[model samples]
Each structure stands twice: as structure tokens, then as C-alpha cells.
Target: MPTHLIIHGRVQGVFYRDWTVSTARRLGVSGWVRNLPDGTVEAHLEGSPDAVEAMIGKMRDGPPAARVERIERSEAKAQGAEGFKRR
Candidate 1:
């Protein structure tokens, strides 16, 4: 199953999107992360349950400069994400 995560707070302009792309790649997760106009970071990650969870866990702490405040997670239907990207 795939998972979608919407992270809020201090997530933009801090390399969060870039870090998410690299981190997800390292964890072998497929999906994308983007910066919302409202200053939130949204991501869609697909992989094994464990891998997805790992990615989410890291997102909660983002880069050392990031201060993640809230993470909303929900199960998502697989969308066949080809690779990790930042947007």
C-alpha cells in the first residue's frame, strides 16, 4: 500500500523538499515532495510498510534546520510513483 503525508510548520525554504527527495531515495521509497503555498510540505510515498513508515518518521524531523510541527498521514491507493522528486 502507498501512503500520503502532509507535513506542517517550518517546512519550507529549509531544504526540506530536497532533503526529502534524497532521504526517500536512500530509503528506496518512491514518491514526491512539494512545498505548499501555505508553507507546508506535502509528500506521497510508496513502498513497503516499513519503508514508508521510516520515511514518515524522518519527515517528522526533516533536516537539522527544519522544525516539523505536525504530520498528517493517511493510507493511499497506489499511484505507481516512478521516482522521488521535489516540486
Candidate 2:
């Protein structure tokens, strides 16, 4: 299944995107993560149900330097994402 997430908090400039790429790749999840102008991090995660859920849990905590406030998630159609990337 695929999931889209809008993560809010001290996500940008905290290595959040880099961490996400590492974590997602490690979990074998394929998608992209980017920093929104509104200071939130947006991501499209596509993988196994368990992997996606695990990624969500990790996003809630973010990187050690990040203070994740909340994460908004929704179902999305897979886009045949090949690998995790930071955008």
C-alpha cells in the first residue's frame, strides 16, 4: 500500500529528509520526501503494509534533531516509485 504523510514540527534542516531516505531505503520503502514552504515535511511512502506503517512510526519521531509535533497521513495510489529520495 501507499501512504502520503505531512509531518509537522522542527522537521526541516534537521536532517529529517536524509534520515527519511536512510530509513525508508533500509526498510525497502520507495518514495520521496521534501520540505514544504510551510516548514513541514511531506512524503510519499510506498511499500508493504508493515513497512509503510513502520515508516510512519519513524516519521513521528523523526531524526534526533527533530521534534516531530504531528503527522497527517492518507492513503494514496502507488506511483511506481523506484527508491527513496530527498526532494
Candidate 3:
């Protein structure tokens, strides 16, 4: 599945995006993660259903520093991305 995620609460400045990149890559997921101006983090995750779900699970407790309040997920078209990144 290709999924868009908006992560909220104490996400920025806590290395959430870098943690996401590492986690996504480790899970063999492909997509991009970026910090939003609204003090949230956004990401696109594309991979097997299991991998995507796993990635999302990890994102829930990001980097030991992030206090993830919630996450918003939605379906998205595949980006055909080769790897995960921090945008």
C-alpha cells in the first residue's frame, strides 16, 4: 500500500523525520518524510502491506524522543520511490 501519514504532537525537533527514514529503509519501505510548518510531520510510505503497517507502528513511537500524539493515514497513489528520504 501507498499511504500518506500526518504525525502530530512533539514530532518536530525530535529527529522524527530521520528516524522515519531509517525505519522505513530498514523495513524496506519506499517513500519520503518531511516536517510540516504546522509542527507536525508528514510522510508517504509505499511498500508491502505488512511493511507499511510495520512502518506506521514504529512511527507511533518515534526515535525515543518523539511524543506522538496521533497519526492520520490515508490512501495515496504510488510514488515509485526507490528508497526512503527526508524531505
Give per-residue CA lDDT, model 3, range 1-87, as digits (tens).
899999999999888888899889999999999988999999999999999999999999999888999999999999899998899
Q: Write the per-residue lDDT of candidate 2 for residues 11-56, one digit (tens) a residue.
A: 9989999999999999999999999999999999999999999889
Clashes of each: 0, 0, 0
Candidate 1's C-alpha runs over 4 A off are: none
TM-score of 1: 0.96
Distance from true location, Cα of 37 in model 2, Å? 0.4
Badly placed stretches (over 4 Å) of model 2 are none
Candidate 1: worst-modelled 10 consecutive residues by lDDT: 33-42
At residue 70, candidate 1 shows an lDDT of 94
List the candidate numbers ranked by lDDT, top first.
Answer: 2, 3, 1
Best by lDDT: 2
Across residues 1-87, which tens digit of lDDT does each residue of candidate 1 receive?
698888998988899999999999999999998888888888999998899989888889999999998999888888899889887
Cα error, residue 71 of model 1, in Å, equals: 0.2
Q: Provide TM-scores for the models.
A: 0.96, 0.97, 0.98
